[model samples]
Target: MIAAKRILRKAQRQLACRKRKIAIEEIMESKGDPTTFYKLVRQQRSSTSMGTEFLTLNGKTAESIEEVTQTWAQYFQQLATPTAESTYDDLHLGKIQDDINLINQICNSSHQDDIPTITKDEIHTAIYKLNNSKAADIFGITAEHFKLAGPSLITALHCVYNRFIKNQKIPESIKRGILTPIYKKGAPDNPGNYRGITVTPVILKTFEHIIRQRHQIILEETQSRLQTGFTKGTSPLVSARPTYRVHNRI
Candidate 1:
């Protein structure tokens, strides 16, 4: 399986250092009581993502168990949907809104969706109102001047925000699947419009030596080395769900 193979490679990288010697006593200790041997097997699987939590008296070594389980769990956790509140920033929001306005106009939504067929005058008025709280000053006909659009603005806003939210999730998956893979394959003859793939070091190195090689701080590899100590084989050792949140008023 792809998951199993990925696990084996990772485990091989990590355990490369710990392959000194194992006495018969230690090997026998692993086999003595079926219960004890079983515990070690579970322990081996417990630290990885492969779902090998409990098993029969299995193979000579349990290399792939931990890595596969850990990787799969990580994949799912990254699959989590981000909340709208913490997901977008002011620049992103503004660009989204701008694009949406243009889209609505193109779709004839402004006319068909019952939104006032906004002229240059109305747009100017709204811009002034948006710029300052003096909405009444902008709109000459001002009783209790509060701008209201029909279905078009509402639909456009919702759709644009939805897309912006999706965009945040896109880069990572692209890096993991498409972008990183292309980078690893090397600079194409026509590297047209390729948003640089610096996501994975192994992939990124094909382009340039951006970060240090053979550093002790390789997060995934280091985490794998310390995985058994950090987790109950549930999730990766996370710091915290990103502490940064946009403070801008929507």
Candidate 2:
């Protein structure tokens, strides 16, 4: 009877494992359904907990919730802290000063018309381009909020953005963002194993979108064709094709 029970338990475990494999295979085989694949992957994870409960810092394990939170905060704060700028020799420093003076002269000589003002249409286009269902920033505002906002809000944004450009200033609140630590493979307690993903306010993102759209053509023109990374219409393959041809000729 004991042997029979052991055999039955083994069969049941095997059956469960087969079912899991079949489910994953089905999810993978389904075309154009990344959502289902990600759902299945998430479900398979042992823990989806975002809590820093198991975190360790400075050779000490954090015990309480507050301590864990503080540890995470300290870790991220250290990462965000700017490093000291490298000192340049007198000759290099003088050359940098000359470049700065030239830039200042150019800016002073340029007309106000050179800087384009923000328009309501640009704001509308930016809002439409924003992706929905994203995590909110420190202000608890998401892309969906901007998308669903009325025309009056667009006009208001246009006014505010124009003011920002005119005065060359932006609100500190807009600069603030929320950092979420996502775990990468490693010891769960190690802070270095996680990468911080920053979410900024939707308004700021909208403004940036408009700026990028306005300057994209000029920026793309200025960039070299060799710059495949982060550039549109060019990828690793596009860069490699030339090298492959050269190798073939050789």
Runs in model 2 deviating more than 4 A are 1-50, 84-113, 247-250
What is the TM-score of each predicted model, taking all chains together? 0.18, 0.69
Can you write out model 1's per-residue Cα lDDT over 34-54, one digit (the tens) per residue?
556434333332324122221
Worst lDDT run of 10 residues, candidate 2, spans 43-52
Tens digit per residue, CA lDDT, model 2, 1-250: 9999989866764565455456545645653675564354444432443344457888988857788778989988888795545774768778988999999999778766678888888899999998765565678787878877789789899889999888777899789886666554456578997666667788899999998998887877797878888887768778798889999999
Question: For each candidate, what is the lDDT?
Answer: 0.35, 0.74
List where candidate 1 sits over 4 angstroms from the true fold.
1-11, 15-80, 84-88, 104-250
RMSD of 2: 8.7
Q: Give the winner by TM-score.
A: 2
Tell me which residue pairs clash in candidate 1.
48-66, 48-70, 49-68, 49-69, 49-70, 50-68, 50-69
